[model samples]
Target: MRVADVGEFGLIERVTSRLTYGPATLLGPGDDAAVIAAPDARVAASTDVLVEGRHFRRDWGSARDIGHRAAAANLADIAAMGGTPTALLVALCMPPELEQSWAEELADGLAAEAATVGASVVGGDMSSSPTLTIAVTALGDLGGRPPVTRSGARPGDVLALAGRTGYAAAGLTVLSRGFRTPRLLVEAYRRPEVPYAAGPQAAGLGATSMIDVSDGLVADLGHVARASGVAIDVRRDAFEVPPQMRDAAQALGADPYAWMLGGGEDHALAATFPPGVDLPPPWRPIGLVAAGSGVTVDGKPYTGSAGWDHFR
Candidate 1:
């Protein structure tokens, strides 16, 4: 049925009925809270919210994109803590005019993406709203290891990152400039592909502190700096934005540096490690851990937008 032709609950019924749950599920769906097990590991939890206009644009993305993104965002946060995602509890709010089919498709997308990280959606809540909103709470297990948080980088540690940056911001620039959304850029904007393996990799390699670069490389690393009580430095000349990004920036007449330095939501893994710890390939070393209390790019103070804020 068309999106405008169906109401919400009807769509939810269709989606939930189709899932193939795993053996790990103690309780699945139809519950106020789903029970899960992490008998041998510590449970790590994280939550995130996406508002209609602030977080997504329906005109630029499908219902599937929204579901995938909302789930991915929460899961990445859990991963940043050096945990493996176990399950998710989703809450959704939608306007009365929304099609039930849209919600069903969204659920399908969420379920599929969660499965990619070995996670399942065991329960959820729904309500009517003036516009679409999504809240996802993700739970993970630390596998007998302590959480790798945002406060451990020490002097002389190596600063590195796994995964690409600037693609989403460049995508946004293309959309705002009245150009057709490039398929890659549109996908980047819709569902940021997080390096789910990087978090555990960092933990295994004895990373001192780690954080996901959701809010640009420089800005998010600053979060690590402030939290760890150390200074971080990033080398701009060593930075590389993908070719597609350079082309997109040219098309939009914008500086790719701004996006690379300040763009958010790419969900890359950034961490600091002591000497001789072998960082896996593509977790490119960007700079060194310094002896101060903030992050600097190219050995100097970076003067630009740090990242997003609730009130700008």
Candidate 2:
């Protein structure tokens, strides 16, 4: 039967029946809001959207890859909040002619990503539109700790990062060139496995300020800088980014430096810490917070044209 026959609510009801609610779920999928049991007293939440053509190409990525990308994007937001991803809410809009198998594969990909992040798809909605759009909202529980917001960095705080950057930019370049996707970049573009564990670890280990690197390194930290009322400086050569980036970038006549500094969608973690905060093992030091407001990279302002913002 067609979706027109079942309708929106009917479809939701149909899909909702397949889920198994656990005891941790204070409230499941029926009301205007889902009441979660974060009695620990802090909730970390984030949302993001992916649009057809802008975020992905149907010609290049499978429906499953699309779903994985969308889910990873949302989960990364949660990780940036320094919270454990407890659950997710997804909303999908697409053209009428999109195939049923496509949706199912997309669902599989979404499920796989959420599971990897230790989150479940608690609830979501489906609708029909002229073009494909995905909106995902991720919720996490801080388990009684105060959230590490973009503010709160002190002048002496060391800037640190967890997870890879610039790989997605490289991946996009590969996709654009009709190359048979580089493994690392394609993996990055398909599903950026945000370092979920680092968020809570950073929070527990005494992080001062935090944000996910959705926008470029400089741009995301700029949010922290403006929020914390401090200047931030990033040492570009600090992190060993993917080498495939150089080759892919040169192939496209793109600057790997620009890609490293400005290309986003990496969903890497960036946070500040007081001197000797006993940071998590794998996290790397990349910059520092200073007594001013703004961001400097390797001691200079990054003048690239591509940090994230709609219609920019």
Candidate 3:
């Protein structure tokens, strides 16, 4: 049945009926607004929007895949701030003819992803539109620690990474070329495996600065460089190119490093630490911070487009 057949309230009931709440959610759906607990006396919040065709394509992914991507985009932001995600507010705009089952699946996807970090879908809104759009707001608790902002990195700091990068970008390339034999790459593009725990872990380990790798490693690090008044130099040899990525790149006649350095949406946490600090598993030293401005690769500015630019 189409969403229009059920009307607004019916759709809401169908979506919320299966959702599970976390400890932080005092009031969930069927309320004016969600009341979430903030035991730390502070909350870290982030919001993101995904538009059909522009940010996603229905042919490329299922409604659930889009839902997971939208939630991860915002949740990872909260994690980047050294907080634990507690709740999510999702607002969806879809065409009247959109399938009712599609919306239900989308809600399931959002709930499943949130559950990974012990978070919940507390509340949301629905609207009819010509295009499909999903907007998510994620709330997090800092656990009484100061947020790891982008401006905290200092010269001589160790630039570290806590998750895999470029896999999604490589997957995107494979999909764009009308090929999907590499199921792994295609899946990565559809649903990123975000290292949500690494954010707070890095904060505990004294991360001077941190950011989620959404807009590409070099571009996002450029934000850190400008904010902290420092320069970041990423080592080209630091990345271990997976065989799958290499095979996809070779098939597409593309440089895998370009995707690794410039691809976005993997949601990997990039952080900087003080010298002599020991990085835990999954947190590896990938670069260095210096007394300068801007991001570089192997001591030089990256030649290609550094990352995604919506306007460009």
Find the candidate with the highest lDDT and give its number.
3
Tens digits of per-residue lDDT for model 2 on 1-312? 555566677667765665554444678788886776665776777888888888888876788888778888887777776777777788988676766556666766776777786676677789999888888888888867788898899999999999877887777777877886667887677777678788888888889988888878788888899999999999978856566776677667888877777878878889999988776666889888889889988888778854878765
TM agreement with the true structure for every prediction: 0.94, 0.91, 0.99
Residue pairs in steric clash, candidate 1? Answer: 3-99
Q: How accurate is candidate 2 locally (lDDT)?
A: 0.78
Best-first order by lDDT: 3, 1, 2
> lDDT of candidate 3?
0.92
Pick by TM-score: 2 or 3, better one: 3
For residues 127-231, could you state the per-residue lDDT of candidate 3 as single tens digits?
A: 999999999999999999999999999999999998878988888888778888588778888999999999999999999999999999999999999999999
- Model 2 RMSD to the real structure? 2.2
- Which has the better lDDT: candidate 2, or candidate 3? 3
lDDT of each: 0.82, 0.78, 0.92
